[model samples]
Target: MTTPQLLMIEDDQRLAQMVVEYLAQSGFAVTHAGDGAGGMAALERQLPDLVILDLMLPDADGLELCRRIRALPGAAGKVPVLMLTAKGDPMDRIIGLELGADDYLPKPFEPRELLARIRAVLRRRGEGGLAGGAEPARGLRFGSLEIDRDARTVTVAGQAAELTSYQFDLLVAMAERAGRVLTRDQIMEAVRGRELEAFDRSIDVHMGRIRAAIEADPKNPKRILTVRGVGYVFAKQQD
Candidate 1:
């Protein structure tokens, strides 16, 4: 298997070098870009399998860069992005996901954790299957909401609904087990192959983003229903 190629778009040279070395050791071919513009130029040269984007950049905002990446033509637009945020703020991570980042790690993180996150994101990008081998067939339909597993696409009312790679997987996990109330732990484990972090609202944030894209009214979501203290469930009756 060819090593997965990755692009690191970060302005901090020292930190970027350290991450590059670590990821390279873990069998990734990494290309370093100093800033957003440099990152764009690198993309023009050759698009990597994944992108590690820093939230802060000299030339352009990370969120805007993420939007631009998603706007790129064809498969480039669907390339998975993992964001790095220096603030360690929940809102920052939330915003990153909302802007199309597949996953995020706050700055001053352990290299091992970053590696784990990267693997998880890549796994969701269909580099591999879930705990079980071989995914089900494509086209999971529910009223106006349609999920195409093969294409990794979602649409509501015949309109495409933009979702991060993570969000799409999470939605599939829930929708596959529709009518079942899944706790946060179950949802996290099923979708990410990991335990939920204590006090972490990452799942909630991603859920909100998914609802915004798929629900007719995000304020009052019907398909993905919340079970209050328990967790959430995808309604069996979509129509």
Candidate 2:
């Protein structure tokens, strides 16, 4: 089996070195870039399996860099991105996911947690094996909303909905279990093969993004219903 390659786009030299060593020890081949420009250059040379992007960079904004990365041609554009930010604001995490980041980790984090998040992102990308479970149906239809697992695409009312990879997965997770209410921890564990942390609203943010893509009225979502104090459930709609 080929080892996964990771590109770390961070300007903190000492921190970067420590991460590189730790991740390398954990069986990842990591490449370090000091800034967003350098990271882009490195990406041009060879697209890594996953990108560890730092929100703060000396040469460029991390959000813009993530946008550019997702705009790249071919598989490079589809590469999973795990964002690291010093800011502990929930809005930052939401914005990162909205910009196509597969996962977000606040700064001053433990290396073990970073490794776990990295593995989770890679698994969601279908690179770290099928740890989530058996493959879902090739196509799922609910009313006018269409989910094509084979193509990893979603369409609503015959119109293609633009969704990030993470959003798509979260939608499928709920859609697959239509009519069943799933707790936040249950959803996270099912989707990412992990548990949600205390006060972790990441799932809710991703749900909001998915609702915006598939729901007729995101503010009043009908497909994915919030179960208040429990979690959420995907409403089963008929054709």
Candidate 3:
């Protein structure tokens, strides 16, 4: 297996150094950037398997930086972002997610947890050969909407739809079971590949993002229907 490259944008040099050294032991080659601009420059230098972003930087607000990263062109824009929120604030975490972060870890966390989270996020992007011996699933289609599993791309009327790594996996999980009304737990479990102890409200945010990307009218979504009191169902048939 090839070592996964990582870019960590953090102002704390000591923490960054420790993380770099620790992750190196786990076969990840890390590149560190002290601020948002340096981080963006490093990103332009080479795309890594994942980016570890700090919510508070000396030169930029991490939320604005996250927006900028999402605004980048092509695949660079789609690179998975894992945010580190220093405040341990839930609202900050939610805003980061709204701005397209794939995941978040609060400050003063265990290195082991960080490693696990990194591996989990990377796996969602189909990195690190996480699928093992299983055959890759084929693409799915519903009228103008096309989901290419291999490319990890989604298109609406041949136009690309922007989706974060986790959102893409969530969509694929539902698309794989069209017409079946899956509860929130089911949706989470499907995307996670295992059972979750509690429901994640973030899935609703992801679903909204998906609708905005693929539906003509997000307010009246036809492709992904919300069955109140139950869950959501991917329309088996679409225009």
Candidate 4:
């Protein structure tokens, strides 16, 4: 089996080197970037199997980087991402996860724990059996909104809606299980291959964005609805 290609984006030189060494030793083909620019550059040159991203980078923020990574075309869309940050705030973790990170690791972490997280992410993603391509054949329709699973495209009242790969994936996952209360953890598992961190409400943010694109009125959304103490549910269009 091929070693997993991993990109480590961290501004701290010592920590970056240590992570690179540890990951490499753990059977990952690792590349280290000291700044956001370099990290993005590395991504453009060749996409890795996974990315270990630091939240505070010199040139760009980690959340934006996660969005960019998920926006990449074709096979790159399915590559899992593990975010690293010193910030232990739940909000920060939620935002990172919302931006399409597969997992999050607080700073001053053990290499072993990070490795375990990475393994879990990979396993979850792999177990899904979701092959990269356009959308699948399954589709869910509600009023003007039609989600083509095979095409991986969404249409609002017949006009195609432009969505990032991550956004499209999130929509399809929720729509497929419409009406079922999917907790953030379950949604994370199905959509991004990970769980939400405490204070990480990024999922809510992304869902809001999705509502804006799909709902006639985001504030009074008719499609995606919140499930108190659980997660969110995609509502079927009312007759």
Candidate 5:
């Protein structure tokens, strides 16, 4: 197994050191950046397999940093991000997801749990997230919209769509079950292979982002439809 390269952007030196040491034992190659500027410089220098971002950086807001990361040109933009937030407000976590974080861990968390979450996110990326014993297909298509399972790319009318690794997985999860109304809990379970925890509303946030990428008009989506109080459905016949 290849050692995964991870870039951790955090200002808390003591906590950063502890995490670096812990993850090293698990065979991860972690690079620590003490501030947003340093983190962006590191990321520009070398693209990592994943980024561990802190919600509050000394020089920049973590949410803004995440948005910048997504805007980066080429492959640097699409790296998976696992956000670390110390705030007690669930809004911070929700906003992190909205801004393209692949996952989030509350501070004061067990190192073991963080390790587990990291592995889960990476595994989902590698396996194409079709984890329920289903044979992997080549790809899925809907008219001008195409999802290439192998390349993990989505293109609308030949134009590449910007989707995070996690967002791509979420789209595939729904496309695999096209035309079916998926409840938020069902969507969460499909993507994460686990149910949401206590009133988690990140699903809506992510879906909105997904629509903005794939839909011609996000305000009036045709491919993915909201079903009133039910949930959402991927249109069976899309243009």
Candidate 6:
């Protein structure tokens, strides 16, 4: 079996070398790039199975690079990207997701956790020999929201709704299993490709952002309903 390839784009020399070594030990073939231009050059030649991109690149902005990657012909529907950022602000996280990143990880993180996240993203996209469980066939449509699995696009009232790759994945996970209660861990596993850490409060923040985009009243949140101490449920709409 061919080993999965990863592109590591970061300006931090020590961190980049450490991540490359760690990811190599984790069984992935990693190519390292020091700046955004180098990263883009490498991508233009051959896109990796996944990308580990640092937001604070020297040559160009990481978010802009992500957008460029998304715009690339073969990348629009393939090659998931995991953005790495040092900032932990909720808005920044949301913005990264909104910009088409598959997932975002705050820096000063454990290497093992990073590997887990990489595997999770690849698994969710049906790579790494992990078959996805059953999903809805006809696709899910609720009010102005339409999730087309085949196209991998979400449309709001016939117009494409701008969603980060992670948000889109989260929405699909809930929509397919509407009315089913999903725990925070389950949701994180499904969307971010990582289990929730103890005391991690970011999942709720992401969920709230998702609701604000999809629900008629984010304050009330009819679409994604909270289940008290458990998790959340995607309420099935009846016509």
Best by TM-score: 5
Residue 205 in candidate 5, Cα distance off native in Å: 0.4
Which scores better on lDDT, 1 or 4?
1
Candidate 1 residue-wise lDDT, 33-137, digit = tens = 999999998887877889999999999999999999887765432588989888977888778877788777888889988888888778867732234566665
lDDT at residue 101 of model 4 (Cα atoms): 72
Query: What would the TM-scores of all predictions be?
Result: 0.90, 0.85, 0.92, 0.71, 0.93, 0.71
Candidate 4 positional error at 95, Å:
3.8
Please tell me which model should have the higher lDDT, number 2 or number 6.
Answer: 2
- True lDDT of residue 162, candidate 6: 51
**Candidate 1 TM-score versus the reference:** 0.90
lDDT of all the models against the reference? Answer: 0.83, 0.82, 0.83, 0.74, 0.87, 0.76
Off by over 4 Å in 6: 71-78, 86-95, 127-138, 143-145, 156-159, 180-186, 189-192, 196-201, 204-233
- Ordered by TM-score, highest first, the candidates read 5, 3, 1, 2, 4, 6
Task: Write candidate 4's Cα lDDT for 110-183 as tens digits.
Answer: 98888887876665444332334445457678777887765656889887665544566778778767788888
Model 2 clashing residue pairs (backbone): none
Q: Quick one: best lDDT, which candidate?
A: 5
| Candidate 5 per-residue lDDT over residues 74-165, each given as its tens digit | 65325899999889798888889888898888898899888888887887788887659868679889999999998899999999888888
Candidate 4 yields a Cα-based lDDT of 0.74
